[model samples]
Target: MGDGRANNPNSHSNNSSSNKPEWLEQYDVIGKIGEGTYGLVFLAKVKSNRSKPIAIKKFKQSKDGDGVSPTAIREIMLLREISHENVVKLANVHINHADMSLYLAFDYAEHDLYEIIRHHRDKVNQAINPYTVKSLLWQLLNGLNYLHSNWIVHRDLKPSNILVMGDGEEQGVVKIADFGLARIYQAPLKPLSENGVVVTIWYRAPELLLGAKHYTSAVDMWAVGCIFAELLTLKPLFQGQEVKGTPNPFQLDQLDKIFKVLGHPTQEKWPMLVNLPHWQSDLQHIQGHKYETAGLHSVVHLSHKNPAYELLSQMLEYDPRKRLTAAQALEHDYFRMEPLPGCNALVPPQPGEKVVNYPTRPVDTSTDIVGTISLQPSQPVSSGNSVSGGNPGRNGWRNKSWQHSDAARCCTASSSTAADKKERIRNGDDWIPSTTEIEALLSFLI
Candidate 1:
């Protein structure tokens, strides 16, 4: 119940406030869940009711340096403002004066899209059923649509960031998480680029790659398109190698990979293409290549004429203006087709055979309930044999035994950066590494 122990005595200095916040005693800290760029996350429960589990995200706070991380502030502000079923809920906030740490309590999500997709592709040794895929995408779109309508752009929309409810009445419901890279795009002090690189390289839109200073929520749509393709193929669509050295705005290599399949974009196709800061340099490289437009079907392996493919194409459209908005994407006939998007992403329609039992999110039992722990790289653990235990509460998955002991890891589950992960995908390696390069890039810019 009461933070297990008092705040670390050494955490407070004579000049600093030693008083612990009132909310600190309210939640029973269970154990550490996972670490991120900002700070560590812990699985916890209300002291009054142990049955109700929640996730508490502790953001890093520096001593004798800056105050709370700006990213953390932005996340708190935006999350508190937006209330939607498809979005992760922020239930409470706690400030530990002893360490100046910011803690956010949110509804705990048992699984994420990355884990689900990886389980099917590598562990389950089968494709995720179309009904499941449709359901997840629909809920994702529903959330993204709400954000866009409210003039918010989820700059970083990737598999790892999309959370899925693994149990409870909200079981299988998809909730979009990680507002660290999200931005209120209605108006801004400067061009979005002034905030440094936004989306991850793999899901990054073409305009961002070409150094488009002023951008729109369409960037998020482009990412959703990439995510849709990944869901179907169980692999990133344009898994191009990230450019090293100084953060180049042109990113010719990434563009080359996209052009190879989607074909080169011309000024005629994208009216603003020629005006981008790095457009001239990018054009120089693109002009040398005679790349033919390879339709989405060739790369994704989906039905060439299916509504899903058509929608994918629209989402991955070269021109941001032409890309399907979340609202327009939801209106696509893909959702209207047979086997309509279901309420749950994991629930099988017309149940018969048993499904794979996914493991619960790994929780590190070693970490104590110390006030505001530092962000340390956790030892990568398989989804199976997590510290908290292995039962992923899914209806069809219960009582099913797995033949293989070592289940495949999610796309970003490992310690690899997005760029390195893309390289692994290119090299045909099964081990995928996941890191938020935005934080790395922002470190350089800041």
Candidate 2:
């Protein structure tokens, strides 16, 4: 069970093996979309009245263990219980009898925030426009608020886990995905870590990194603060080196950056700081020393950065106790000041509703598409469409192969085949477009 694999061992073989499950036989597997530490993502189509497309994550059980990794199972279980526009929806989960593997289905998204930021570095650097930065931070705060409201702490809150759904007009509809390291808080005084390290190093809060036993939602707020800074700088706010004394080293440089930008922390201002787990030991060397702030007074200061200096300062506070909550952050001056234009806008359909076909089999139309789009458990639809001989429904479109000729593009709800190809390249997926392409696109769009 501890092995980094799925619950079913045989799923590692070719999907076309004769022993495949009957329900899975109908879906035509396209090329792989992504491969992770424990599973593979495939673009697939369902055979139904209205063929639909979907993304399926297939997990192969460890050869020496029972089933899928517990982490994957936990994500499925948690996501299945939560529903929000800002959170990725888990459509379905299937277990293959032949190999005992688990397959999780989800709505397909175009690009991840990490790729977008990395690609648009130049545009971000030339001038950290207030609108673009505010919009991104606003959406991020909105998503975090929704999650925290539900008591779900996304331990891993980083750019890579934040995905973008639409383009241009629909740019701000971000969805927070990947819940493998998430947890539900049942008590306010609960400890943070469950066992092994949870969050990624870069976005980890100081308390968590210092091994705090009892933590709260503030940990996530800190990560979001880090993300906010990254959005402005187009670079990680905390790029500590893995080893000390090298060109780079793991230290509290991010704290220094924050103080430099917002002014030094006074004991009276952040009284709890000295009590933090490693505060005394870690700061022993820097004690009494006048540290030169890194980004202080620079033209790239938060005063000119997106979201405003005051708002950013509250979020990046050294004292977790004084940090702004996600809900409070959403009400901060940055979002309230300009209020990201059209923040609630949805992605519009292309000129016309034209169906684009992928190599996979058509979708099943009798099934409920809307219901499947939610992570909540599916309610029985009385449409009389049985899995064996049913129509998939109006939204039935097989999840197209992520490797199709047009895999590099983005598609509106109504996009032509030609438009699909163009959309793919425009989304920066073509041959894994370089970072420059992203910068160029951002420059044009922003």
Could you say which candidate leads in lDDT?
1
- Tell me, by TM-score, which candidate is best: 1
Evaluate all candidate structures by whole-model CA lDDT and list the values in order.
0.79, 0.62
Write model 1 residue lDDT over 102-217, tens digit each, in one string.
78889899999889888888888887788888999999999999999999999999999999998788988999999997899877866777876677788899989888888888
What would the per-residue lDDT of candidate 2 be over residues 1-446, giving only the tens digit for each residue?
11122223333333344443445555665546666776667767666624455578777555665556878777887888888877887877775443445678776665666765675574333433456567667777788898888888888889878876643434447778888878887753335465456666677776655546667778888788778777766787776544345322345664444445546556787786566555666665345556555353252354545456666667766667888899998787666664353352232233342322112222344333222222222232232223353345645356546567665454433367667778887886674645868878888765
Clashes of 2: 42
Provide C-alpha RMSD values for all models, in order.
Answer: 21.4, 22.2
Query: Judged by lDDT against the true structure, how good is candidate 1?
Result: 0.79
True-vs-predicted CA distance for residue 31, candidate 2, Å: 2.2
